[model samples]
Target: MKILSDTIKNIALEIRTGKTPPTSNHEYFGEEINWYTPSDLDKGKFLGKSRRGITGKAISDKKAIVFKPNTVLIGAIGDIGKLGVTSDFSSSNQQITGIYPDPKKVDSQFLYYWLKAHKQSLLDKSKSAIVPILNNKDLGQVKILFPEYISDQLLIANLLSKAENLIAQRNDSIRLLDEFLKSTFLEVFGDPEKNPKNLPFTTLEKLCSVIVDCPHSTPVKSKEATNYPCIRTSELTNGYISWDSMQYLDEDEYKKRTQRLIPEAGDIVYGREGTYGEAIRIPKTHKFSLGQRTMLFRPDYKKTNSIFLWAMVRSEFVYRQAKKKNSGSTVGHVNVKDIKQFRIYNPPIELQTQFAQIVEKTEVLKTQYQQSLQELENLYGSLSQRAFRGELIKY
Candidate 1:
């Protein structure tokens, strides 16, 4: 790839802290400006939509500068190297820096992706005293390679845009499939809202082994590696958990930390709160252990199939029940007490096995669907690298 040395910076303004913001809306005292956070960005680069929005009035007296719709927003802290571009007019908090690229000298789209591709490089220099942050000086100095002329830049952007559309279509398909899976669950079990069962419900603790969430006191952080599976809420895509996005854990750390709850093959792990009610069966590869804020369920083989238990937990009725019992001022969470009382339907073991078979079948198909989508994503990535290298054949 040819190297172009020109650089870009965010609108040069003095840094302002949140409490001493340059602007503020008196109505919402705690609201930040309609700014996007680092956590809002996805690896896929399509920032679907964000629920958090701040306004000019909210940032009163703070650095209330606004970013133009065309500029790309970069994460400068905790979540390193997340890239977001505006679809509508917006501004961001101090955690994010709005990049006003020199579009005349560089393709903003290309520069955005190039920064995305080299996110780690940006992150490496994002070290700060109290928090990890990308400094303005480094961001402006970062060089981007470009084609000899604007036409080449346009050509590259068009190709990437094509791949983006394909990826987006596949994303939509995946979402559609997820809806189908929810429908399937309803088809299998009667709808929770309308069809509240008169059938007897049993306490989860009585039906199976209930492991409480890990201690939140202090967690041993995994040092990231090239390839080892780590599970967090972010990896759960749609209704199913995608293991591919996980952080790699060293064997020693994995074994040491999760030793007490190195889960069994059929164990069902539950994400206890926030985006709660997701339960994933332990695939043989990751039958390792539990993380903080996660609950592990080991079904009694004679009474239930693990898959049946998974469906049972995720059903609308269960989520409603979980929601009702949640506590906390800021974020509601399901604790061991709440989980112990979670009701389970004591249907015949035969029916449990049957449902397990169906879930397994769905999983098999889902795996294939996920693999195809993943392959397309990989292909797009490979094409991006090749296109940058000038190795991709011009069509």
Candidate 2:
């Protein structure tokens, strides 16, 4: 076993801390800098972008410290151990501390992943009354499995860098798919503003029929194992359905919920509740029943291409339209009637096929990208588990 111990004085670092200073004009808190909160730690390892930003003057008035892009951003409050690298120079909440390596002493990526892999442990070691926090004093004292060889750190960094590249590619593919949809809509329908088509484009009722939701509510608790799989809208992704996380209903339960939705091949299932208008095409291979939140529109295959319809659902126009017809006050929902009444521009078969081809090709590439990401995540999981366990050699 390799044993290495080192201690260094790690002082607490913070941005402006203290109650909001009241100013005579209320302009003191005007120029606030970007402050990432603990809730922003959901990106897992690396945070490329942030949601909130404060004013620049706020930093000066509050004496908030500016974080360098290379520094390790660590949360000190409730989320005591979560870690990320400040890709873009930015400030963090008062409870955040920037962990700077002693010039070339550590790889930032290595540090981020090390802390991320050991997040729970750091949490356990922290001491706090109201909220868990690892003060600056304890931050440097916390010993991690630091390699004596810098080469080992660089090697791991390279591997992780490649993994990061794969993730970036996946993100790009997703963006491109969205772009293709946007482009397809513009090509087929032309800008609804510039040239509102003179084609026989009318109410969505003309295209297909039968837009239906599942059982009005969640199924009653039952233990009976059914022959069919029941899936919810939450499970759909990018027009594909995954049965890996599906629930199995018993025969009796299925018999009782007669309205339970059965997805037919080419049936486009849409999310009517949370992610309203988000839809997935039910491939023939998808053998399952739809849950309550899922609304399946069995399009007349002869009139409308299900693939085209699924792509349309992902468009901004349909999303806004669905939101408009939503029934509930707080949590919006879409019903069958609302869906059929929704209009669609009927392009020629050639145009429909051309758009379908683009979507189809992009989907295939997306599937490959998804698989690559999953494999990379799994590999990272294994590598991290082994590395933290002292199983990884100092290569």
Candidate 3:
């Protein structure tokens, strides 16, 4: 596998950083232009309409730099390797670097894929491990490996793009399954917010047998793998506890943390601070303790089903309440006092169980989709490595 390499600066016709207009100036922001942040890079290879935008006044006042369509954007701050390609004329904040590929040297899509393939290598050049920062100079000097011929570059780019599209399709399938589950919930129980079925309205305190807040202090963290995992706010993502980023606690610490009550399979866990309102039913797979800024709910069997209670907590009905009740202005967090007063639309136990059964069946399908998605992602990673090394296609 033969490959030609050059620094990004030599291949790029122009390199520029994005800038943000003064936020206090109300005249600067409108829906006129895409104002991208590091977060927007997650939308895929090509940038979509940004969540926010700036007015023409911002561009005229020299408060923001507008990049032409097809410019490649890369995260330059904490999230060092995040990437996006502009789909239209756009401006971004200071945390992104825009590169205009020199047509004679490399194809735009090829450069984008090449950067994706060597993301880890770029990450390695970050100045600090604690708070990763890649300055313009380091980023400019970053090495790019590609086939010398433009035709080979296009072939490699197209191959990787097709592979990426497959991965995206699997993800879309999983998301559709999630939507179906939500629709089923609505059909069976009606909206928790409106309670169109005229179900009994009650407070969260009466709905559960016990509601326990997590230990206020951080537990002693173990560096090695252990049977005891201390679930943190970050672990609660997209309606589930992701153990991949979990912190392990020593046996003694785990026991100490669980002194109030042990977490069980059916118990529901909610993040009260940072990513508040996201809740997940504790699965039967492992014995774990809750970390700070989280709370636990044990549904009374006589009153409701665990999954039903979890579904209500995860609903937009509760999310809106959580946001309004946030006590901290800087770091949003919901208080236990406010949480206990949350109004819930309680349907009969029988109807709740029926919804739970539907959820269980839907989850099985989602698991299959997720497994397929993981395999596709792994395949893409492998193909990317080979494609960049000039082994994917026989030239």
Candidate 4:
């Protein structure tokens, strides 16, 4: 193990800040140069391209400095400890610091991985201020356990790279499945915005039997298992209730919290605040209480299919309405009144049922892909821990 200061050749900070920002359409104005910021860096990977580019005029005017390829970048402001390696000639905004490794002393890929592994530790050292910051000096003080030989470093990097690739592949499969579902929805119902099929339009209130709000106040949570699970906005994801991170509520608390309504298998739960408009259909009959900042909708089965309603609310048309109705300085929210007023395009019941069947089939495949992805992620975590602790070499 060696202090980073001793092993690295140089640490360079990006000089451009608020004073000299490239024009928004720099490509049309001047010579194009790739410019990166904290947002441009993907966690634990190299940035081959950047979304925004700065003009060469900025460089010629002494406003920016371009770092050569293989330079390791670390975010010093906003999103701290985001790491990325650069390809070809590139420059970053003032918020990132570039680390150039000494070829004779350390391999660039090895440094990248080491920094990725210790990102949290680096963030921990950040000064507590209005905005968290990790300066060049703090970055230089980081301590890493480096192998004596470059070959050893390459071996560790290669193993971790393979793990990342597998995880990425699994994620790609999941994304493709989601895209398929979206395409199918468009093909069946047409765009909800345009109503190109001239489907009957109705207010969301008319299609549902009941719309109940979550308890205004937060309920007391318990770590121990209870008869009821409390569903919060955070637990709503991918149009389903995630019980993996749910909190518990005892009988008495559950009864009081759910006095307004108890969700049934076909009901839809909508997030009203923060992550607004995330709607999930209740998959089965379950004893659960709603946490704050959420709404429960029980669709009239004869009028609409539960899954179809879920898809409609989750669609861009409804999302835009939710966003427009949302208010609040710190935390935006859509009240029950606005939610009830949301307009929904109603297709035939038979078509809605068919769409539900298609969704169910797609979800089954998605679940399998998600499970595989989680397993790969776990494997990557295990390998990373072992590789850093000098345990992988023995095996």
Candidate 5:
């Protein structure tokens, strides 16, 4: 094993920090190359697609620098420690530093996993400023221990790659289930935006018995387990609450806070600020209090199904509405008024119930996929920890 500084070759740092020439400058989409940034890197995976592209002119003018395939890209600014490997000739913005590993001394994938394993340490090296930034010089000094033989590095890379692939496949299964539900929604309800089904359009306030946001102030948190879990916007994910991450409040405090709008099993919780437009249904009755920047909506069972309402609010139609109504300079948020006023296509109660039933069935499959994904993630973490520590070879 040796320090990463000794195993790596040249570390190329890009300094160009302007927007690539727009689509107007390119003859066609083919003339543009994939331009990656810190956002494009999905932690350990290299997302080859780019939201923005660099035109041929930008590349020709030296406004963007292209790195060859297998070059490990690390985020140098804003988002620190994001890692990825270029699959093809790709250019990154100024915020990234590319590391080209020595083929004889180290494998690229091994280097990637090493960096990922030490992501937090690299992040800590960043200057504590308004926005943390990592310099190439500082990153170059970071230490990584690896085997002397490239074969060892290859072996470790292969093991970690297999773990990553399993995690990805599990994620794909979950995504496909979500897609199936969305496709079914569209097939049955028609596009909410187009209203092809000619369903009656009405404001959310019309379909629900209650539409109210939580108190705008933070509740006093308690360390004791006797307290009720407080559901915050950050805990909302995949149309459900992340119970493990919820904060806690004293029983009395929780009772006082939620006295006006306590969340029930049939109610839908909507995140209003920071991470707006995400809605999750309370799957079961629980002693919980609503945190700030979130609202509660209890659908009238006769008018709408809880699952249908959840899907509707989580749909693209509602997302567009929320985006349009969002107001804030730094962090956008939708007001309770905006949420109440947002239109939804009201279909027959029986039809909405049918969608809910389908969702219930798909949720069972999603739960299985989620459990497997979590297990794979845990296994990957364990393998990663052991592999870098030189303990994986024993297995």
Candidate 6:
């Protein structure tokens, strides 16, 4: 494979950063032009409409830079590797580094994919500060390895774009499954907020065999991967535990941490501090101890199942109730006392168990979809790597 490489500065016509208009002046902000920040960069191929915009006054006042169409935007601040290409004449805040790629030297879409594939390399060059940041100089110095021919660049970009589209389709499938389960939950058990069925209400405390808080202390995480995972609030997403992202601890630390209650299958882990009230049931195959700001709920089979309790805590009604208890705090949080009093619509045990079974089956399907999505992601990564290396093309 014959590949050519050059610093981003050498390939681009210009490298520039943006600025925010003075907040004291209200006239400087409006919908006159699209303005982006780090959060707006969602790894999308093109940067279009943004969450906020700046008026012409801001641009006229030299507070922002207008990046032309096909200009690549890389996150230059705390989020170092977020990549996107400008779809129109757009402006952004200081967090974005705008690159106008020299059309003769590199294809815009190819540059986007190449940067996407090597985002970690950009991260490596970032200055390790409290919040990691990449400077324009460092960004301009990023080495882009590419085919000398623009036709090959376009071909490689198109191939990788197809792979990305497949990966995206797989993600959409997984998300649709989640939406299906959520709707099904509401169908089986009427909206918790509405309580249209007027089902009998019960406190979570009564429905559970055990409601215990995680140890207040932080676990000393193992530098190397270990079997003993310490589950944190970050790992709780979409009613599932992201086992892969969990921090691990030594066996001794794990034992010490689980001294209060070792989380097992059928137990619900609830986040209490940061993202208060998000909950997920512990899977049957995994064993782990709770991290900070989390509590465990063990459903009493006689009253409710783990699925019911987990869903209830995540429901709009219970979440609103939980928020009410924490309304006074500067940082939102739920305490054991408040959690114990949370009222929920409690249907008959037979009905709860039926719903539990339905959820269990749906989860199994979701797991399969997730596995497929992982494989697609792996394929996309491999394709991106090879496509940029000149291995996917023939002269």
TM-score of each: 0.73, 0.76, 0.90, 0.87, 0.84, 0.95
Could you tell which candidate, 1 or 6, scores higher by lDDT? 6
- In lDDT terms, which candidate is top? 3
- Give candidate 5 regions above 4 Å deviation: 1-34, 43-68, 88-90, 194-198, 223-227, 243-245, 323-331
Tens digits of per-residue lDDT, candidate 5, 250-359, equal 88898889878777787888999999989888866467778988889999887888999999999999999999998966997998888998899889999998898999
User: All candidates' lDDT scores?
Assistant: 0.66, 0.66, 0.88, 0.79, 0.80, 0.85
Better of 4 and 6 by lDDT: 6
- Cα lDDT for residue 206, model 1? 72
**Tens-digit lDDT string for candidate 6 (143-187):** 889888888889888888888888888888889888887787798
Clashing pairs in 3: none
Q: Over 4 Å off in model 1, which ranges?
A: 1-3, 9-63, 87-90, 193-198, 209-263, 271-277, 284-296, 323-338, 348-354, 393-395
The segments of candidate 6 whose C-alpha lies over 4 angstroms from its true place after superposition are 327-330
Clashing pairs in 4: none
TM-score of 6: 0.95
**Candidate 5 structure, TM-score to reference:** 0.84
User: Candidate 2: lDDT over CA atoms?
Assistant: 0.66
lDDT, candidate 1, 147-227, per-residue tens: 656667767777887887888887777677667767776666557555544445687777776465654533354566433
Collision pairs in model 6: none
List pairs with backbone clashes in candidate 5.
none
